[model samples]
Target: MSGTALLLVLAAAVCHASWNVVAHGVSRIGTPFLWWGAVASAVLWLPVVPFTGGLGGSVGGLALGAGVSAVLHVVYMVVLQRGYAAGSLSTVYATARGTGPAVSAVLAVLLLGERLSALAAIGIAVVVAGVVATGLVDRRPRQAPAPVDGAAAIADGAAAPASTGGASEEPAPRADAAPRRRRRLDPGIAWGLLTGLAIASYTIWDAHALRTWELSPVSFMVGVTAVEVLFYTATLGRRRRELLDVVRAHWPRVLAFGVLSPMSYILVLVAIQTTPVALVAPARETSVVMVAVFGALVLREGSVAKRLTASVVVLGGIALLAL
Candidate 1:
């Protein structure tokens, strides 16, 4: 990638992570925040849509791609919500986001006939390893206080008359509070996998669509945003009110996320158009590293040391890919 393209990718990575953090903070209303994001994004792309000429030869293909993208986005949103609910954002987001570009790279090879250099292959491996390590480390059991015996509880209650002893009466922690045994259908892992697949599908399909159609970027973006709005609105129905509530409650944040997300995507498209897909995809994956850092430092949600280490590993992978 040229220096300009690389810089644009980096900027997009930052935007990607920031918007994800914003999304994580949204009130849990299935599909509501998504609709809000779509609407906001559409508004942003509206002005540019007018500049795009009427649909031509590849318009159908692009529209079909947009429809596919909308479905994938819904799936991605579902998984993202489940993942955030079930696991630490640091771990789930990093793993999901990091694995996407690697999957995209493979799909690009199979479907788009894109090739990866040796360095890029190594970089992808490193990213995958880092994602695995991050997830495993998060799965480690957290310490819980031992259950208190009845006699001990009585004695502690009796001793509570004395200020010193009562001060020592630490509440017995419930065993149930311990991390639940990993189910066969671990929601976090499932969601992470789905997220990866959704993103991979989006990237691959979008790439093909772009190649097939000569539509201006703004026009393509508006079309996709419109499709997304219709899909989410139909799927969310009565629940749409709940989504509206979230928007009303957090309009500023939602709007910011909406702006950043589409802008980041636009930047990525620009970069991909200018550079090799191999280069742009891996570079964009660096958002995983940024998200890990943001989760640890900004969100303050996980073990700082583990998050930092995982982030470094992810960055190392990106570096290798860039080489």
Candidate 2:
């Protein structure tokens, strides 16, 4: 990766983390996601609709790509919601984010006929291994005992004398005494895999389309966003009220999220146009580490040690990719 491409990928990583934090921090995930999509579509489409004269010629392919993307987005929303609801924020976010680029790299080779240098392939393997390790560690069981120290005294606020009770007679160790619950993998992880495939498909396809049609970046985003709005409204009409409520309550954050997301995608797309797809995809996965950090410090979730380690591993993988 060139210096400029690397910088752009880094910027995209920041944007990806920011939007995810906004999505998860909201009171309702589904509604915020919908609103984010709508606002993003409007932001991209409204300003440049008039200047898209050249885009008119490429409308068919752009629309087709957008249609595929919209479907993928629906799947993404579903998986993202379930992933956040059922698993640790760091674990699910790391898996989903890391998996997409990995899939993209593989698909780029097979479908797009892109070649990765031997070094780049090694880098991709290291990154994938790191992501897998993070997931494994995040899923391990934890032990958390109930608050027993507070109840060891009498009503007189004095310490109770110790009793030589047998080990089995020690209140039977509380029948409910069990290790802290390990979150179950969301069935959405499967959905997340599908979502990642969708993302990779459209990204590679769109990049090819852009090259063939020579569409300007602004116009391409506008067209894709317009089509996405139509598709989302058509398919998710049942959830309109929920979607609207989220938009009304968190309009500013939603708008910001929307704007940043497409901008991030645009940056990655541009980077791929110039750099190797293998390089760009792995570099983009750097967002996984960012999300893990956000989960620890910003979201204030538990498992700090695991998350920190995962973040380091992810960064290490990114470094390897740069080589």
Candidate 3:
């Protein structure tokens, strides 16, 4: 691969992970965030449509493709937000990234009758195992609670209980002071799998639409992002106050997602013109590792070593699939 193309792919991976981090940070606002994202992305990218390739010679197909893609992407965004709310960043991002290509490969085989070599089959298995590993990484056994401060408790005059009808004067415990529970019940993995399914749906339809209509990457992205705005507006028209509040509170994250999300895709598309897709595709999965590491280190939500180890395994499978 050319050095420039490789660099572009790596850059795209960073953008992808960066935007995902942005998404997780503000996902609590839900539809408000999605609405702002659609609007900002469309406005940000609209100007580039003409320069990249206007319509790719098919206005009708562009509408159809963008409409369908909009639906798919909205589903993706909704599910992704829910996943972020439900689980740690590491588990959700790692599992979704790993699962997307696995779902795509399965679809290609089942619908297009594409055959996988032995290596590809093994890659699928490895990906599945790695996804599970990431998902379960946060479900670690709870550490034993710290020993209570007997000296401080005694010095604080626990004898006050005698004044309260002999009721124990133990402090009303802070809400989060309890030992961890329900680690096995975290729904992050399930939500991640759902998000991955949404990713595959959009990826398949978008690929077919772009190739069939010969749409330029820029035009197609602009069209789809525009459609997304319309969809978000139609669905969220009554949420003006909520939307405005999110923008007021988190405009930095909103704009970051707006820029980073599309930039990631556009960079890969541009790189694909010069690099073999086999290389570009696997390079994109590098974000799987970056985000996992981000979650473990920056977010401090899971075991760093466990998430990093699982992310590496996922990337290994991706490399094999690329082969």
Candidate 4:
């Protein structure tokens, strides 16, 4: 990564971690929160789009890039929510994040014609390892319930967002309902893989959009947020009341997520303009360590030694990338 690219991705990481920290209980609220967040993002950032670069390309190109990215991002949320509902949280979260950067790195090299140095490649691998280790920290002997999908979560009173891309803290399924939602044969690995692919797909495609189409990051993201708001609204069905309740009760968090989530991704898009996606992909995983720090310091969670070890490993990997 170029030094500028590195700084941007790290800033993106901090933004990503900050919102995830702020959105602690969003999973319990489900689609309503994401809906509000999307609405807020579009409305909040629309004005800045013109100042940043306006379409920065043809309207057709901007629509294509933003439209496609919106679909992929929504798919990511749906699949990730299902993964939460399909298996253990730790299983889904760890597997998806672990798989995402690896797949993104490989595709960046093979499809995007980006090359990574041997040491940088190793750095990417180490970062993925540390991220998975951090994700794995939530596992318990009794097993937490799988998370609920957005639509289902509306009915069940739970919902989760994507990480890197957004969050996965949907409340565990009700104890009595957990068994039926979980698959005895598959666990969460299947859904996790699907989620991982979705993550990589959007990551690569969004990079392609910014790099190939030359769309302004702000405009593209604003378009994406607008499309997502529509998609979420169409799927809301009879849940309009839920949306209103969330808006009224949690507008602050909705606002925080709206601003930070897109900020995180917009920064990543900018980084990808100057840096190879292979490096930016794994480098973004640094957010996982920041989240661990949040858990230790803010949330007063346990696993201090383990989180510290993971942080050290992730930092070491980052050092390798800088080499």
Give the distance in Å from residue 175's predicted Cα in candidate 3 to where it truly belongs: 28
For residues 232-272, write the lDDT of model 1, one tens digit per residue.
77777567567657877889876885688787787887777
State the lDDT at 278 in candidate 2. Answer: 64
Which candidate gets the maximum TM-score versus the true structure? Answer: 4
lDDT for position 177 in model 4: 89
Task: Indicate whether candidate 1 or candidate 2 has the larger lDDT.
Answer: 1
Q: Tens digits of per-residue lDDT for model 3 on 1-323? A: 46677678779888887777666645434456767776777788888787788778688888898788877877776676566555554455556766776776676567544566787678666756676576567753322222221111100001000001223467866767554543355566787788778877776676667666777777777777777667666766566678767889889887887787778877876765544343344456667567667868987866898888888787787666556
Q: How far out, in Å, is residue 203 in model 4?
A: 0.7
> What CA root-mean-square deviation does each model show from the true structure?
11.3, 11.9, 12.1, 6.3
Better of 3 and 4 by lDDT: 4
Error (Å) of candidate 3 at residue 191 is 5.6
lDDT of 4 by residue, 1-323 (tens): 67788899999999888887777766566667778888888889998987999998778889999899888877887777777765666667777877888999999998999988999999999998888888777555324453454642211011233322223477867988878756455556788788888889998998898888788999988999899889988887777778778888898888887788889888988888888888888888888678777778777765888888888898888888878
The regions of model 4 sitting more than 4 angstroms off are 142-147, 151-186
For candidate 3, the TM-score is 0.71
Residue 171 of model 1 has an lDDT of 77
Q: Of the candidates numbered 2 and 4, which has the greater TM-score value?
A: 4
lDDT, residue 102, candidate 2: 82
Decoy 4 TM-score against native: 0.87
- Give the C-alpha miss distance for residue 25 in model 2, angstroms: 2.2
- TM-score leaderboard ranking: 4, 1, 2, 3
Q: Which candidate order results from sorting by lDDT in descending order?
A: 4, 3, 1, 2
| Candidate 1 residue runs with Cα over 4 Å from true position | 50-57, 79-95, 131-136, 140-187, 242-244
For model 3, state the Cα shift of residue 245 in Å: 3.4
